[model samples]
Target: MTLGAVAVLASVLAVSCAGVVLLTEQALTADLDQAAALRARDVASLLPAGRLGTTVPGAGEESSFVQVIGPADQVVSASANVTGQGPVIPAPKDARQVTVTLDSSPLGSEPLRIVAVPVHLPSGPGWIYVGTSLVQLRTTMSTLILLFTTGLPLLMLIVAWTVWRTLGRALRPMEAIRAEASQIGHSDLARRVPVPPHNDEVGRLATTMNAMLDRLEASSRRQEQFIGDASHELRSPLTALRTQVGVALAHPDPEHTRDLLATIDQQTQRMAALIDSMLYLARTNRSPPGSLTDVDLDDLVLEEARRLRSIGGLRIHTAALAAARVRGSTVDLSRMLRNLGDNAHNHADSTITVALTTDNTTAELRIADDGSGIPPGDRERVFERFTRLDQARARSSSGGGTGLGLAIAQQIAHAHAGTITIDDGDRCRGAVFIIRLPLSAHHGP
Candidate 1:
């Protein structure tokens, strides 16, 4: 049951119980007061005023003990109950008077409720007193109290039961939602937690949870597809190399076998390098750094460019260097420069230039290769995993290229809260890759 319903029921029951008790007490008191007043009136009407009529019938010669007194202080008649108890009641000094119980009795339980009136007749004026005990009043009130006490709790119980049942029924949508959620799996992300067509908090919660599930399912499906594509792409070269080796091994001739063996060796090297590149990308995805730290990007870029030059494959040059500080892994920075250098060597007219600089809040590394420039639209997506220029595949030599190199470089940059983009080179005629990294993060990696 919801807390709101329970609270409402408790408040209602409390107020009702309190009201019943108060109203009952006031009403019972009023009834008793009215009954007592009537009894007093009857007693005053029956009194006598003259000695012939004013004398109380039970009064004996001991007049002081039970006689009624007139206005002249003459003895008339007396009440046994009133006169028996000494000075049981004060002599009436006014016409309108009140009675006081003379002695204790069972009647005291519902004591006297009366008013005495002065009597006047041809003989003289005197006083008569009357009262009614509170016994009948008590019995009426007790019955009321008993009924209220017994009935009130039953009412509260009914209220509590109604609160629990109604609240549980109102929240029945949650049960359906739970059932739907329990059946949904990573494979069946298309399913959604059902939400009722109601503008309420529970409905809103169901909608929000369903939206979150949709996004998670989409991300999971994308990751699965990415792994499958990577596997297929990696297997192609492996299968070709294996077939080539089997062919060469079958043909045993001195010079021909040597040539075939060398071809096998080269293909084996490319295959191993591709596997390594795939592994590097997989690691970056698996363990992304929480932050990027201080790195000397200029030195890192210069070092990787020189290493590419070691193979004596491309004319690599650099802009006059400066201390370019950035928040990124040194290894990742070098990997980005080396991949750009290798890409340039693959297609350039043999020239590569590396540049580095820092702007407010953004530090950048730019590598330019005098290669056939990437088309404007394709430049953005080339860094996606396994994507390559359609032209690069048909070329006989590939400068040790694996399609994942640029993709790996992009992943590493993003892990550092940075980006890698391709732009127009020095003369705006060849591919230029620029990496941008954010600065001033206040926490650790």
Candidate 2:
């Protein structure tokens, strides 16, 4: 980039210098032509008084040659430097000045710029020609050309060097940031890029990168904790299964073996459920719910109520059921409802109520039970993975939950751009899980 910038600047300087030389040449040429015309006019003024061939005062300058011509274009008088040369230029017919160039002249064979002006001589109407050598103009232009050719490169070199140093100083902070960032790893995200003192672009970049690293560190810690929790949760069922099978094998009794098989099946199913829940959470974490379709919240609530009634022998009520539509994945919506129903069934003493309703912009589903309500302090904690509110609710069920159901349900709710909160049940006088999802545009009035 530096080289490209220098190259472009140099090209502009070259063009500018060339233009200056051409303009100087034109201005100098015009000055020379004007001087010759004035000299011709002066010489013509003397012709009315002085005789021909008489040496005129101030007419023998080294750079100028003056001559007088007759009607026939013959030289009648000449300056000392060109005394024998014919008229330096052809005689003009009128009083207007004409500038002409001479190939060979008394001025050492170099070109001469002569201006011929018609004048009324004492004898008749003749012409006066004044000529000047171009050596001085040529010398001035040559000097200008030499100076521009040499000085412009030197100037460009100085400018390029200055630019190079300025850029190096400006980018030194970025280089330091790159070096620090290169040394960082997943194991060490606490280190941060250095920020320059000035509030410039590099400082802002350093600040942004540090913020990104902070997020990455937080995410990494959460991932590690999740993996650890999942491993611990899986180990319990596997250990129970192994112990039961070992005991049954040692006894070798048919009835005992059958009971052991049942226990093993239950443990295996529990493990499967835990694994499935973990997988769902992991998948959702990696990629949130995509391409939402309209899901009937009322249908999902009724379906989960029926399933929970058959499984838990709890009286399920849906008196508030209404035709409410939400935009989300149907499968995820079903999973959320099922998890809420299971949670309500596990905690309820005898009845689980599933209700659906809608407001101006949101569809709300409430699942409540008549069990001991969750304490206000533990309400938020119940949604965390692997959390079990054993103090608030009983954990004496034949197949206790894996504790990820409510967490997964909350995640699903958030993915649908909705919210889930624990509140006091209106009818059950127990904990109520209120889910509010954005209403789909196509929902019926």
Candidate 3:
């Protein structure tokens, strides 16, 4: 980039210097031409008055000279510098003025600009010639050429060096960022690029890069944790199935084999459920919702209540369900409700209450159980994948809870542009899992 900038500047400077040289030479030449014309007119004026002398005062001087010629092209009078010179220039023909330049004249070897003017001489029609030296103009042009020829290179060098240094400093931070980023892989996401101190474009770039790195590191940690937890969770059912199969094969008793087979079937279902949940999570995290339709949130609540009642142990209540509607994927919403209901059934003592209500913009669902409420600090942690509270672990295992129910519930809620929070908002005994989803534009019964 610096080299390109220098090249462009060099072209501009070359054109500008050439223009200046041409303009300076034209101006100097115009001035010398004007002076010579004036001298010729003055000598011509003296001729008509008959006061013209054999030699003019400025004759043979370095500044100007004059000569007078007769009609027949003979030198009638001359300047001291060109006493016998050939009329300085040929006399005018048909009373027309003529002008020319002499490379070498009787005056000197230097060049001269001569102007011939037709005059009405008392003797007859003749011509007067005036000459101006071109030494000053030539010297000025040579000096200017020398200065431009020498100074332009120095100026271009200075400009190139300046652009190089400026661009180097400007890009230094980006180089550091690139070097650091090149070293960072998925395993090294924790590292961040160094930030420059000044709040310039480079500094802002470093800040954004560091911010992105922070997010990538956090996501990497969450992914690693989820993978580890998923592996551990899946291994339990696999191990139980393995052990049960081994026992059934070793012992040939019919009743014992049947029980072992039943246990194996149960373990297989649990593994399937766990894998399905993991797949659902992966899909939700990676892509957007496929389609959406208006869903009756209150209907989902009553459905979960009926499901819990079908399980027979838990008393289900859905008294406060109001006509609430939301726009979301029905399958995802149903999965969310099922997960929440299963969680409540597994943890509730005897009563699981489900209620949904809606206001102007939000449809809120509350699912509460009568079991031991979650601790304040663990409320948020309960939504993490494969997280089971100590008090509920045994029940989770016995009831075939995948430990992904709440996490899946939360994911679905967020996919529907909703939020889930565990709170005692309704003064429930156990943790009240409240989900708030945006109300459909047109709500109906």
Candidates by lDDT, descending order = 2, 3, 1
Q: For each candidate, what TM-score against the reference?
A: 0.65, 0.81, 0.80
lDDT of 2 by residue, 1-445 (tens): 6788889999998899899999998999899988888877777767656754545457788888888887777777878877777766656655776888776577787778887777877668787778888888889999999999899889888988998998999999999999999999989988899989989998999999999999999899878988898899889888888877787777778867767787777788888888888889999998979668998888887787778877856788889898998899999988888788778887888888778888889988888899888888998988888888783653322223888889999999999999999998755378989999999999886
Candidate 2, which ten residues in sequence have the lowest lDDT sum? 391-400
Candidate 2 deviant stretches above 4 angstroms: 35-62, 76-85, 91-98, 101-111, 117-127, 133-136, 253-255, 288-291, 311-317, 348-361, 366-381, 391-400, 421-434
Tens-place lDDT per residue, model 3, 280-399, is 889889987768998888877777678778889878888888998899987889888988888888778888888788888999988898888888999988898777886446534322
Which candidate tops TM-score? Answer: 2
Local distance difference test, candidate 1 = 0.66
For model 3, where is the 10-residue window of minimal lDDT? 391-400
Q: The CA-based lDDT of model 3 is what?
A: 0.82
> Where is model 3 more than 4 Å wrong at Cα?
38-51, 68-79, 91-102, 116-128, 169-176, 247-253, 256-259, 292-328, 345-373, 390-400, 416-418, 428-445
